[model samples]
Target: MSTTEDLTKDLSRIMQLAASDPHDIGPLLNYGLDWMLRLAPFDLVAVFLLESDHLVVKAARGPLADARVLRHAISLDNFTSIREALATCGPRLFYEEDHAHGEGDPFDGVLDFPHGHACMVIPLCFGGNAQGIITFDRERCGTYDSQTIQLVEIYAQVLAMAIHQAAQSQLLHQLMRESNERERILREEHQAGDLLSPLQSKNPAVRELGERARQVAPTPTPVLIHGETGTGKEGIAAFIHQWSERRRQPMVKLNCAAIPESLLESELFGVVKGAFTGAVKDRPGRFRMANGGTLFLDEIGELPLPLQAKLLRVIQEGTFEPVGSDRTIKVDVRILAATNVNLQEAIGERRFREDLYYRLNVFPVQLPPLRQRLEDLGPLCDSLLGRLGRRLGKPPLLLSENTLARLRQYSWPGNIRELGNLLERAAILARGSVLTPNLFDLSHSSDVKAGVGESPTPSADASAEAPMISLDEAQKRHIRMVLNRVNGKVYGPGGAAEILGLKPSTLQSRMKKLGLERKVHFEA
Candidate 1:
């Protein structure tokens, strides 16, 4: 066949494959790269697919085809030619000699291509928007003529269309899967008719909270969950999302405290290319991602004051611009925010915006501390044990009656999370199906409560003959027991301070006030 006929046939074949199965972009890309190699002599070919803010190598041909590095992502800022091509939605060419002025080759450490060559980078543009990049590298310099570049651009356009079609198909499939999963969950919920089963609390405070959640779940009102750390705030947020009318849509979560302030804005509101040093492409923020769904912001108090104003605008107007773009994008997102800190106190300190707090606190739900709801301890233990048992491949560890009484005597300052940690440790130490108080590290149970200026009460079944000591003497004895258990180690994990749930400094201060020393002798 003539060259023109071959080129025409190749383009026809590409269209046929793309139209045959829009869900399979892998075969299309692989076949296109092979055909391109046959049409033009090239030492290497690589295809990078745009994902969020980075280009990921989706397919590669030539010597390094099987290299594990192909799976890694390449930031747009790392390559000048690719960035330029993406910015202009066009092709870029780089020659080895162009970097003779001591500027190192861009692909020197990136790819193991043969030295002293030329590379052609074609931005995959569809509908005047760049989706990704396809690069061709030749061992010989200046191998791509004007006609060849034009042909490459045309091929890129075809590939871009196929990729975009496949992406849309994948998204459709994802939506279907989410719908199915949501249906399954709704079916189970309907069958049980209990949305608060996950909370597993019989305590009146928890029951009231669950009832409040049920009442607010059907509304589009913003919910602000307030509690101390480890008080199951996120769990409450998840419960709210599952019970809400928008349960079919995903609930995207972000921890304001986990992300650094410098990057938190872009993470929440997203950014366009050149928005910052590493932003290589336009990306959607959590608000856009959570459109028609719920956005659960954990540790909402930790959100910086500057972003607080932007977040308030989104709540009020349902519109905001990306980090670098002035175009205001509107989204319908249900806000569900949680905070362990007191936002009112933060407002008083001038650290948090008072307006934002009011916006989020439209339907406030405050969770009770574990100590206040001691009646739920037994059920919580059973639930946690069942979960941990299955995860650890062990039978459920049963807590003895005496152990329950012992647990109820001490106040849990860390709440449910601390109880879980302590239970996990005891479960690991337990040799039989039954767990005893000996398996736990509650030696400082009285001391920890005392350190916080709380009095520890004895179990209900304590013998009548037992001597009653002053609170200070009881605290001293408890602290002494914890120190003895760890062999005088005061700091670090598994030490007296950690096991007692007291800060090292606080533990030391209590020890000094009680006239206790590191070398103090104890009864074995």
Candidate 2:
């Protein structure tokens, strides 16, 4: 048994907890039950809150139950004593002798234990309102002294106040979040369009690009389309094939960067049944599938040096021998390659072969980024919004004039793909027919300079505007800076890999691609 001083300390601790202004109601229920059980000799104690119309067990403790015993619940209709406690806003004591078959036992049909011989349900009340009942049960059929009951009632009052305050705070936070999101939606606007079909824009640059593709479609000369990521290089390749003589034949597509180096050769050329382990069946690679048609190889710059020589051989002689086979298969396939990588820089780094570059770059087509082609924004939005709205079950989505102006001022790092995705998201969030987006909704914020690739800002030393550095150059600087900070440690805690959030193997691969060998950069 605890002394009078101990009980007084517990009451004060609960009172202080109620005054602390908590955001969650769970802690109050748990802490209150811990103290309530100590006031009397109790084998079981559980707190239940009236949520909607059901009395749900929120927190509990006993030899038969753990602190997280919230899986039990009962409706007020099935709980006569609990309903009486909530209705009178007072505590009611009961015994097994008074109710036959434990008809109104709070834990009846809820827990797989006896109702015990004696139990009581106390209404959790504050400000003349009640939300739930707290249950106390004991093994022996007996009475709780008036002093103990009085002490428990006082604790209940403090607990009820604490739960009320925390619930109000929780409700307030939810409302504030909803209110903030609504306010943000009202302040910005955008419209979207789909690019599943070919782009026929009013812009002369876009028109000329389409005409150029049509002109080259008739020739056997290989073409390479190059641009920043998300500028739609794949679309250009498809457009050329659509107008080509081999349009009826299959135009097989492969992304050279997506596959591992060890298996890349097998993917490009056919593989025999016993080429390598797990090669149980012979497979005709992408080249054989696209025979008599066109083969579009995206991210061609990522092709390994050894594979590059083989790719060149296929282009020159139109012949390739499958792995682990002596027979040579001939295919008259026209290759169309695409790359975001600056291959000139890749060749200088020796990551890309110089001979292979000339073979693929027979004719090059550079697609202008979305930021440079603002003339197409209005039409693009109108076209994409209708498709997006219909797809999302919100038809005919529209954009404001102010949104178009805002779009022009911002630099689009992801280009047209980013633009389409942004619009689709806005349509999903839009309350009505009009869609609005927050000004800084883009992945790259406003600080990213506008027309980044179109024209570079002037250098401090030079009188003329300096060209923007290539993406590879930027990555090299960032990686080297981290390496220097870690004293050139490539693995382990506080090393370059940890700082960069990259696996050591992945870091090694990137370093190799950028020609950043350990001996060359770290030691030389």
Candidate 3:
């Protein structure tokens, strides 16, 4: 047994170690155990910290020091000695020899302790509150004396102060980390809001489109957005996803036309390990990643017929098998599909599935071409310049009156995308801040030639004048003239669609019926 002088020296050493490094609880517990063994050798020593109503073993010595044993928790209701010590804010002792075996014993032969042993549980109290419990166990009976118990009670008080300070510091650090994460999320949301602000246009067609988007955003119904290429169909899909209830979750996107047909199936549905050549590991597909969220499939018309049927299954049943596995995985993904091709015409040609079209066309949102919404041109130009100027680290470029007039007269076939590209190019060429009409390189553009609404000047000879033609002949002549001016480019910017004010699909159908071959090569 340790004398009073020896116990006093040990307590001083423990306090010194704790004062030097208060954050490290391991060293303090180690020194306390050393002193405890000198007073009365124990089979096990466990220090359990009080976390709410449960005791979590923070440190342990001897046979019970294993990770699994240390992690085990003890409820206050399960142990009378631990509960008594916490209630009295002092120490309590329990001996197996003093209790009956079957019905009256507090341990009841079920507790994980040494058989036929004595235990001393001292509650570590500081500031009139119990912080933790330090338990000591010995194989022999009557191991704890009154003097040893009194010394340990003093040691428990010092340890409690150190533990309470450390816990408060850890909690503060956790709060700071969470605060930083919230700030980062807020900043990203602000930037995304600025990017979508320009979509709110004053044009009647665009306002109607916004209204339609808001109407369908809160539901699970699939939406199909139709427009010409570069008409912001994908942007509308993004707006719907952001406004939906699933906005907090991720929105996965896949461009059906950008990926190859052979790889499209595996990309949409996940693949297991050894399913195919070079597929060494299991990979999750976009559907699984976007579970409980939204999935935007762009250029959905480009999906092959075989995959289209499989896609319809996912839409109808919310379940699909991987490319090579027979296991069917279930997901709850809301789909939003976009396409520039005319599905009705494709259905007539027997190229697109009618049932699949009906399934995807739950709510159709059509975006008008830039030419049809010419009133928004000036605002769109200003919005684009402001955004692009920030990205380029330069001031926003101003458009002269002549340059703005020319832009308004020329038909925009590529819609907002073409206008944004033109502004970006002009901004780069602009000296200081002003942009002139001469900076625009539209000399070879067919839209520029047609916008003037006049043909090349004829020679000053009266004999060169031709007679007036029939309306049917005149329409044919005009179609052939624009097609020739653009060198047969009919679909994209500067194509016949821009000059004729028609969709690409409509123009292709008209040309085919008019017996006009589309093999004429044009400069892109």
Best by TM-score: 1
Per-residue CA lDDT of model 1 for 1-524, tens digit only, reads 87678767877777777766655567788877876775556767888877666888778887656676466577766666677779899887776565453333434566665545777778998887788888777666665788888877777787788777766765566456546644654554343232235346777768878889988998889999988788888777777878888877767778999998999998888887668898865567677667888888999999999999999999999999889876788999999999888888999999999999988999999887775566777887887787778667898679977677556655687888899899899888888788776666666654242332222433333242133344456557667767877899999989988776567998898899999988778654
Q: lDDT winner among the candidates?
A: 1
Per-candidate Cα lDDT values, in order, are 0.75, 0.72, 0.72
What is candidate 3's local distance difference test score?
A: 0.72
Off by over 4 Å in 2: 1-199, 382-397, 431-433, 438-440, 447-524
Q: What TM-score does structure 2 among the candidates reach?
A: 0.46
lDDT for each residue of candidate 3 in 1-524, tens digit (9 for 90 to 100): 45667756765776677566534567877776666665556767878777666887777786545667466677767666667678789787776654435222222333455445677778888888888888777666565789888767876776776666655664465446435544554454444444443246867668878888988999999999998998878778778888899887667788999998888988899776558897764567778767788888999998999999999999999999987777888999999999999998988988789999999998999888876666677777776787778878888667765556557655677888998898899888777687666566655555553423222342223234233333334344456667887788888888988768788988788777666678854223
Query: Which residue pairs collide in model 2, if any?
Result: 189-436, 192-384, 192-385, 193-384, 194-384
TM-score of 3: 0.51
Mind giving the per-residue lDDT tens digits that candidate 2 earns over 281-309?
56667787677878889999999999899
How does model 1 fare in lDDT? 0.75
Off by over 4 Å in 3: 1-192, 195-199, 449-524
Deviating ranges (above 4 Å) for candidate 1 = 1-3, 9-200, 271-285, 322-329, 445-524
TM-score for each of the candidates: 0.55, 0.46, 0.51
